[model samples]
Target: MIANVLTIAGTDPSGGAGIQADIKTMSALGAYSCSVVTAVVAQNTCGVRSFQALSPDFVAAQIDAVLEDVRIDAVKIGMIANAGIAGAVADRLTHHRARNIVLDPVMVAKSGHALLDPEAVSAVRERLVPLASVITPNLPEAAVLLDRPDDWSVPAMRAALPALMALGSDHVLLKGGHLEGEDSTDLLAGPEGTQAFRAPRITTTSDHGTGCTLSSAIAALLPHHPMPEAVARAKAYLHAALAQSDALDVGQGHGPVHHFHALWASDG
Candidate 1:
């Protein structure tokens, strides 16, 4: 079956994160991608220079246009940067339901620029997150969402995982890449308790779109396979993408992880 995935998020002109990353990741994982762009970022590896958000009505229309035709099996949501867009997308999904909905609560850029308005946190937690099948939050985003400071330890990180689960997702993948550690461990806590994926620290500046890629991978994979199996496969794909990130010389500053890495080697 062709897994049709709908990605509702912002556009990254740099092609590292946001809507671009979601589209690339979904298609690479064998899913057809449909996008509803919430905002457009004038961004590159250095960081996001500027951004312009679409009106809530336009965002909804984009989603409607896609869902009206394509049979969206899964939904992967990235940077819904404001409360209005978040609500619009969440409310829209009430009717156009996908079997798998992965929410990557993208609040900050890789370069530390805040993407979502701080005020929109309530809107996300209350309106959007509860509606998701899975919610993926990195350390900083988790801390902010949970109202904890940045001084959280591994135990603290694990502690917040349950709270994220409580927010109503069937599963919660709390990415620990932002946590200081020798090996980065992302905690997947859900009804089955926890599953951890640990990878050696891949010290690279090209880590811009990893979250978007991972969530989209989950969304794409889950419709065809079980969640645990899907998450494991998605993590591996992202690791390989990060490992081969050097192949893409797309921009001047921090670049995107190479999605075509496997293709280049296999075709040669």
Candidate 2:
């Protein structure tokens, strides 16, 4: 059966990140996609200009409306915007007993724009993180969540895993893309143990939506695969998408990955 994945996120008009990227990633990974918008953002490859978050009540209503009808196989959450939205989302998802929840703690955009409110950090860490099946956080995001300096090396990342797992997520995928290296590695820590997944860092500016894409890919695959397998496949898919990203000319600063890279190649 096709997995029905729901993405609760903000928007990026440029289509490289946020709800647009989530839907694209889910669809590319062969999952039926649905969405609930938390904010309407005016952003492009250059950066975010402004954003207006929806009311907490409305956000909760959207979640209830979807969960009440669709059989959501999994959910990918990004950019809650504020503490109210975070609490609302957590409450509604909990009420619905949502499964296969993949939470990407998106704090900032690629262009150095703050996508999440500072006050919302605690709400996300306390309310949302506990409910996630897997929480994907980059070095900077991890630092903010843990109230520690960003991990600068693999060993540092390893040391931080226990602390991150203590946040109550069943699994934590600590991304090492921020470290300057030839390869980008992610450390996955769970009840079984920790494992590293590494890929040669593709040199390109077309990496606008990588985080959103990866988390949504995992959500799309979780219904059919185990956590580790889903993460591995999602990593592979993102790698391929990054490898082919430069082919498309979407924006000036940072363009989006070619989500349909495999499909387009097959068609051609």
Candidate 3:
């Protein structure tokens, strides 16, 4: 069956991140996509200029409308701009018993713009983290979530796993893209232990929406594959997208990844 994946996120008009990227990633990965917009952000590949979040009630209603009719196979949640929206999302997903929840703790954008409200951090940690099947947080996000200094090494990332797991997620995908190296390694920690998935770091400024794309890919693949397999496949997909990102020229700053790299290749 083609999985129906729901993405609860903010918007990026540039179409590189947020709900737009989620939909594109899901469709590229062969999943049916649905979305609930939490905020409308004025951002391009360069940076975020400003944003306005939807009311909590409106966001909840959108979730309800989708959940009431569609059978959501998995959910990829991105930017919940504030605490109220976070709580509302947690409550609605809980009430509906949504499964295969993949939470990307999106705190900052590629251009160093803050996407999430600092005050909402505790609410997301308390309400949303535990409900997720897996939570993906890069070094800075993990540090902020854990109230610790940013980890600069793999060993520090490894050592931080238990504390991150204690956040109540069944699995934690601690991304090491921020670490300086030839390979971007991501640590997947679950009840069994931690495992590393590595890929050569593709050198390109076209890295916008990478985090959103990765998490959404995992959510799209989870219905048919186990956690480890899903994560591995998602990593591979993102790697390929990043590798071919230079093929497209979208913005002045970091451009979007080529989500349709395979399809475009076939066409050529």
Q: Any residue pairs clashing in model 3, and if so which? A: none
Off by over 4 Å in 2: 266-268
**Candidate 1: segments with Cα more than 4 A from true spot:** 266-268
lDDT of 3: 0.95
RMSD of each: 1.5, 1.0, 0.9
Please provide, for model 3 over 1-268, each residue's C-alpha lDDT reduced to its tens digit, 9 standing for 90 to 100: 9999999999999999889999999999999999999999999999999999999999999999999999999999999999999999999999999999999998998788898889999999999999999999999999999999874699999999999999999999999999999988999999767899999988999999999999999999999999999999999999999998988889899899999898776445
TM-score of each: 0.96, 0.98, 0.98
CA error at residue 70 for candidate 2, angstroms? 0.5
| Superposed Cα deviation of residue 19, candidate 3 (Å) | 0.8
- Tens-place lDDT digits, model 2, residues 126-238: 99999999999999999999999764799999999999999999999999999998999999999879989999999999999999999999999999999999999999999
Poorest 10 consecutive residues of model 3 by lDDT? Answer: 259-268
lDDT of 1 by residue, 50-164 (tens): 8898998999998888888888899998888888998888878987775688999989888888889988899999888888888889888888878888776678877788778
C-alpha-based local distance difference test score of model 1: 0.86
So what's the TM-score on candidate 2? 0.98
Reference-based lDDT, residue 212, model 3:
97
lDDT of 2 at 195: 86
Model 3 CA lDDT for position 204:
94
